[model samples]
Target: MGTDWVEEGSPSSSSVVKTKRLMEGLLLQGKNSAIQLQLLLKNSQDGSDGSGSSSEELLGKILGSFAQGLSLLGSCSESASAGHDRRVSPSSGESGESKRRLNLKDRRGPHKRSKASQTWVKVSSTGEDNHAWRKYGQKMILNSKYPRSYFRCTHKYDQGCKAAKQVQRMEDDPQMFQVTYIGVHTCWDIMKTPRMLIADPDTCVDECFPIKQELREDAKSDLTNDNVPSADFFLITGLGSSDQPNGPASVSSERMGFDDANGDHAVPTMYPFGDVANSHGLEIDSLSFDGDFSFDESEFLASDEVIELRN
Candidate 1:
């Protein structure tokens, strides 16, 4: 199915081609009609007043007919296209597989065919569309009731495509917002325009303020005395005495102890990989120190201590 659907000028291209043909046909007809009108007007000037009145009506009718022909041609060119924009409505039945087909009338462009200025983008939905997704993992979050489902392209290895999606069903609605990523991972591109590229509606503080090495060192130092002990306790409980070790004991040791009575950890979390962290590279301190960059910060970084100096 790779090349089956990719025609040079798909339906849109064909519709445009048809429109051009119709305009050419109409242009030739209009030229011939204009020549006939010119000849009639020259002869009518020599005739009586009644002859001039009849000639005006005849010319008007010819122009009116030409206008009607152009309109009909536009509709016909649209109809001659290949496919329709199919929209899937919520199913009435429980089966979920049921779909109703809609025939949307095609629209033709004016004589000037131009590409759409704005791009049409789509977010994926597990329950909404007919596309298939493969499950990568299920994460049991501490506060949230439902676990987040991570998905990667099912055709990834076969097609060498790196599209991925994260599906978290809304607590209020049954509909899941499946973000269908079109392209592969381009983290640099995303980091360039943090606000525009990143879909997170959350604050830009994370990107604006890259984690300072001093703060990170402080966090590590703060945890060095306390975390090591708790992590050691976690290792003893999870591993149950294994020399070889079944898996990476560090995960079970560090993560499990972060939980409280509700089994949720209380430690300030840092990213596992330094990919994003390094990209920002101490930019956060400058942004944070500067009063202009930091404004209306929420729960993420609630506490900020500013030392005042008397001038």
Candidate 2:
């Protein structure tokens, strides 16, 4: 009976070995076919002769190999069960549980962030924004020349602000930076002033900065009447007083071609604060002047405009 049992086990083992060998050969064939298919696709993209027939043939072979492997796997399991009345051994059960755990781990894919909660802006300077950001981390992105810098709101811990941003220099234009902001500011240190109105330089109080008016009404009117987002407002600071002996010259609307009160002249505007539109993704023009002005960093920090929509 022992000899008979040994002979029976030998045939089962031999069949399993043959099945494994066949599976390996099929896997190798499929790998080679996939490599050839990839090369064919590359050649086609490169304007080479890409016959559809060859790719279809390779794909069919790969599918056929997979089908045969599955069929073999089913047949092997059936044969093994029929040949032996074997219970699942303790070691094999443990091994299967370990494999299941590994599969669960592998299936836990990468975490994804919602695009709706994020805002993207392209700017010339990374540090031009008024918000205080603390650099947390930097990462070298794949296929990108420059590293991306991650920043969180400075008031994150103290004030519970959830604002965060990522800054990366553009590969094509190194001078330009891509800034991505996540979440709105909920901190108390935020500027609550209304958006500034860009009137003719002649209407400006100091001749250097544009008129300061409550822009919320105009913004609402633009939305209701024109079905468009309101223009961007900037907080202009650091302009020297006209009383200063060496202060920068006062800008004139006539010189800048904004003298037309009827809005006939097309005043060319510069986006020094970047093309930050309102929260609704509406782009508004920014302020520009003809004369030079010195920017005092302290004054800029003290009187910066907190454009809510710009955030």
Report lDDT (Cα) of residue 106, candidate 1.
19
lDDT of 2 by residue, 95-214 (tens): 545666755544444433322232334344443455678998999999999999988777666644455777888798787676666543434332321122111111111111211112
Could you estimate the TM-score for every candidate? Answer: 0.21, 0.28
Off by over 4 Å in 2: 1-116, 190-311
Query: TM-score: which candidate is best?
Result: 2
TM-score of 1: 0.21
Q: Pick the candidate with the highest lDDT.
A: 2
Query: Which pairs clash inside model 1?
Result: 124-178, 124-179, 124-180, 209-284, 210-284, 258-265, 259-264, 259-265
RMSD of each: 28.8, 28.5
lDDT of every model, 2 decimals = 0.31, 0.39
